[model samples]
Target: MTNSNHQWKKTALSVVLTASLLGTASMPSAMAASAAPEAAVTTDALKAASVGQASGTIAGTPLLQSYALTDKLQVEIKSLLNETTSEGTRIAAVVRVRSSDANVAKIPDLELRVKTADGYEYPMQASVFNAHAIRPGTTEELNFLVKVDRRSPSELTELVWYAVDWYSYPKKETVQLAVPVKGQEWTGPLSSFANSASSVLPWERSFTLSPALESPLVYTPVSVNRDNTPQGPVTTVKMRVENPSATKEAVPDFTIDGRSNGNGSTDKTVFPGKRVEASPLVLEPKEQRYIHFAIPTDKDTVLTNFNVLTPETFRQLDPKGQPSQVSYNVGRYQVALPVTSRTAEFNAAKPYEPGQPFVFDSLSDTIDPHLSVSMVEFHRHENEGEGYQTVIAKLLLTNNSDLPVPVPTFQTKLITAQGMTYSGNRQTGAIAEIMPQTSYAVSYAFNMPTENEDEQYVLKFTDAKTAAPASTTIGAYRVAMQETKLDVANMSFYPFKVKLNDWTLNARYNVPSALSPNTPISYTYRMKLDMDIARNEHVVVDPNSSKMQLELVDKTGRILSTKSLPFSGVNRLISGPQFIQFDTLRTEEHEYPLDINIYEVITTPTGEAKRLVGVLKQ
Candidate 1:
């Protein structure tokens, strides 16, 4: 025989013998015992032949084929993806390891590398596996990332995996697998792959509560939407989480695989998923709330199947009154993607009109102070020299419950149909207390651009005191300005019953303007009011409130000057003759008929105008 042929035959014989010994080691106890002596002899002969023969590389295994690192541990590469990032080219391999032993399997220190066709091997940059132990009959998924420097060859040819012995340094079992790179290239920015556009299928998952509780917590997906920002694309997932248990239940921590880079690198390669809105740590008993998660991603990513991990841990007192920690594996929920409908119903916001009531059943379990927004008034005014417009919202709140309820503060916002937002500038009104079955009015002044007067506006309210769920929108009302005109014979306002007995107007010359001395001698117009006033017992009127205001207007309904009726206190509205002085007028003003406006001004203890109640135009 030729020397080359002899060497090839000997190498083939050694490989066959080595394979037999490895197979014997994995057999059942009875079969392994029967072949123990023969396997030992074969192992010795194979080792002797391997010493003299040239070291040959192992053949590459196909992707997804299971390979044995030891008799108890099995591993496979489920998927591979390559992405281009600003820092470098990233090759991510999704690896899964399974243990079939009766005892716990100690995972060996693992090393992974990406081998290119040009003989370049890039070492693993990071891994998701942080532990070294795996329970019997359990499986764990790991993400292995290999980073190639910028401009390096990215044509992946093989995946080189090594299992190194923890005790014996530098000794490792290596395996090479052929990579199918045709469709594995991400071909875009790393953010695009991580933030791929995906939707949750219609799904409802239930988790058991504490042992003391009877009902389970229900979780359902409501909607998914993508928004583009200057930083990147944010994909938000809205979920409806409900706790039907009689006892308060803690909110479980939720995590999604692939939502984070998990590269364990210092570089800010990717951002982690975050809860979109502020959430309460615990769900009140029988409380249902909607939560949102904002994840960063791209438009091209498709999420076929993903796992949501929810593990809940809490401390509970034992029967003996000793505290013990209890952990419940809420479980990893596998969600299928690309669904059309949601399983849970998303509550639609009910539109309200001015003066319509938006009733709130309960603010909390113990504080069921049924409150309602009985009336809403929109008043628009232009600042003469400030170059802006002021929109005032007069809200009348009534307490329907028997107990006195303190008025709730709200984070008020005025939104337009064109997506413009104006924050409330100042709030005024009696906010101390609302008597049982009584009504109190408050005003929120929003200063906006003059050009926005024509836009459709909605007043939105969010609770400012309690840390309510973000989805809890107290109310939204359409702001439509209406002019209230009353008959001159019968003049009566809300929260008060009064009669306009008689009135007289007299004009007098007042001091001239300092800046325009030759302009004209201004006429000081005074009107005396005489009437019988009867107060509404169900109204919460502040003691230090101011009197009704009077405005002299032009023919076009533009207010020319304003003055307040002289009154001692709110309780004595009809004490004696009250005069309203409009001191800004010219001699030419007496020729044209002047229109008068009456406004009820509610005030706080410090004399700040709380609200401009009702308007009566004559």
Candidate 2:
């Protein structure tokens, strides 16, 4: 948005015109002989406007330069670092502005251009800023990141700065700084250039959305996934929007456009289908919601940038108490996608054991007395014949603050040692709020290939806070199970003491219409289990929680059928026969191993944590 008024625009224009005329009169004889007449004039004009230009090369400490735009505003180039990578060169500039006592200073729409030795200037491919404005009588850092085509730092002679004037007409006042580049080439990972305070600028493995909104709505990009189909490559971008205001706000109607490359030839309106939420949705005060946008792109397309446009219009009362139409332009916001898609290189929380608590502090500043999360249990149900397994991760979250804390919807992934990643689906227990100093249990389920069950795996969690999205990891565990004979007694399963008293197996024959009564076409097998469970007080227990499961597995370890038994908090005995039936019998053999799994709900200072004590094979 344009920040300056007409008066400031006039003053900036006059300053540039005066400086050009003075520079032309004093043009040097050597520069004029070496360059064309037009080129010489333009170069001299830029040099004259360049105030407080820094000298020497960018080797040790970065050189600082200051530019005075008006009597009230001055911009300081505090530091600069050029990072070279195989794909491109990134320039990080730490900028600060000092405002006069009389007026507040808004950061000008700035552009940085790299000037080559041959006098060619290349505009930055992408850029991001840390802040938008500066307060009066105060100086604040407004750092930014700019990326350009691959070029040796020594090949660049100077940098050109443009302060765009967008009030009435579009124009730019230019300043040229002579920053020589000389030193060993600094080669490192691109994410290293990201500011620790705000990881959104340079782009990190996981980053929060940049604060580019002009309204009260805060939007955060949660995750992006690409799926290949016969039609094309479909990319789904999930975003979380929150309205932390006193008044309800209409969700902005934003359209996302994507470009495959910098040339913009492949630019397309990517998100054609409407969002999952209803159109013209209005968020209640302090309400948060998640929205998904499905973008179908051309085959073999990799979106490098996303342009979001939100055009909002509303009616307001004028001074005369009459309604007037007003246009609120939130303008366009750009997001630069990372060069590569990989798991997060760093974990915000440490790798915790299965039952240990993970105290996450990264969000402490955003949410007072941040909550802690712990892995209570991990369950893997194998359906070998179907070629897939259903894995569930149960977690306990405790709110340590005195006030109630709303549970954040988490995006989860299960990563194996061999680098295979599976996205989790069907999350439960995130709808309710966690009371202060109490724990709440939640579970995430993932359907993965049965072949991956033997591989070591880890669980990753990402919170959906727009301001500070954080990721944590737990595990590197192989499924632990034990085999036992039928009618085993006095078995320990963490918080539960179990005794399998007895079991019965029966088979029923089914006759086909064409076959005789003696000739059975199919067989139905049923197995009944009688067990006793004693619950301990080590963990908080829920009466209606499904705490145990029985699975009948074939000789090949494929589960043929399964049944779940809900824990009856009133009695320790599960006396009635619990039967599991398999309808189809391919062979005459009827014997199969039964696996019994027990679960426990425990209470701690944190939220309720549930545990899958252990699996019993009989």
Candidate 3:
């Protein structure tokens, strides 16, 4: 599976694409079009040896304009590569899309960007026509890759694409039939592991086979570390058997397959085993072991060879001794090594100052046996626009384990004391299930570093491996940006005063209403609860804690009517003036629009409990 549907599974920064295949064609009105559909030109003897140019636009419209493809499919853009290598400057492009529609057509969810007149935009790490379901009149071909670093090639230029103005091709009970599997082949000698400070390259590979009577069978390999663990970026490997010889044998347990080295060809089978005892492989004489086979490795996977079957190498490559077994032309041997993330290291270990906590009781089975992370707050906020700056943290997670703990998937970074590692921009809260000893409060808003030099600013929690990180410095000074305005007026009722515990709390608001038709509004409010400082701090005002809301819209703000009001006191002691009245109903010529909201939850003589909000407007 060259990129077996590209296998994306990190789950938080998003970028997953590889799904195309499902056919049935017939809608050719000359390939219909009114505009936005140009970029199929490559004939001047094939565009004079082309090197670039495929035009784009899909929500800015223009590809030539005109748009109508609800299942007669027919998209264009054919070629465009910007190649520059050495470790950067690679941008490939090709978009086909062909269907005729007679009952099979689909291509929803689309996005691709590549602009460059020197404005730089490049987005599309993966997702767009990877072939899994696009079969109607047949003509799939959607590939796009981006790398950029050797200085963006030369300002590159043009190749945009986007879809969803009403996308089409999804009906056969909502389509889902791609069926294309066949990828797992091998030749020999191949073992790659990327390096040069891009870190993560811890490898190990061994071999020795001799089936058919079963005598020799070494095969070592262990390196497991699902990257930052969460089962993402995967790297597995596992398989350590031996038995160099001396009788007592049965063998039989190999199975492993992978493929991807150019032009994507996904063969499947990425670590699926069960022969250590689910039967077979008896070994006992010199018995040496470790099986339960595994192989994973999918984030930019590049195999091209990794087939390792058994049953006496499928009965000595059969020709006559066929005891039967046709698992795909039967497998035998092919394990050239090429799994990626060069092994795996997940760096991060030098820069501790805000209360040290980058711990990981070392994953006691997976994420420290389920929950207990830490890092209780880290501030720094200012300069939120134009150049950027804002940290704000608070990640406490605590589930103590009892089932209901699943919060593994993180990737935060801010480092920089000259080590540089910025990268924190999509953390809109996600825990998906916590409940056990209970405690879940995750709130991070990172975005600081402005091109370096604020000195320390660490704040890294890479993947909270199992919680142990508490502070990352970042407290040099900067947290001034509080704008909370709300003081409306047109006088129907308005008043504001906040000074709790030291006295003074007179809040009033009864405004918001203008566009009558369903009319009948009445409001009365007043409050005075003071024990002068103590009469046992007098308390008595919980008419459901006083809260009122009424809405009746029709000026297009939707909302026919809503009402609320209830104040029930249970007492602690109190003496004063409290009058709350509420009645609503407005309807005159049906102009609608009449809203009012008021809340008051008080109790302060030193008992603390407050909730106030009412800024009248009409």
What's the TM-score of each model vs. the native?
A: 0.53, 0.42, 0.20
Query: What lDDT tens digits, residue by residue, belong to model 2 across residues 283-376?
Result: 8998876665666777667776554444333344558977554332221334565565343422222455556665442322323346776675
Q: Write the per-residue lDDT of candidate 1 for residues 209-300, one digit (tens) a residue.
A: 22112235666654454444465665555567677778898665664432333333343343335565454468889888766666665544
RMSD of each: 15.0, 15.0, 30.0
Which residue pairs collide, candidate 1? 195-297, 195-298, 429-610
Residue pairs with backbone overlap in model 2:
398-607, 439-606, 439-607, 439-608, 440-607, 440-608, 539-602, 539-603, 540-602, 540-603
- Better model by TM-score, 1 or 3? 1
lDDT per model, in order?
0.52, 0.50, 0.38
lDDT-wise, the better of 1 and 2 is 1
Best by TM-score: 1
Q: 417, model 1: CA deviation in Å?
A: 5.9
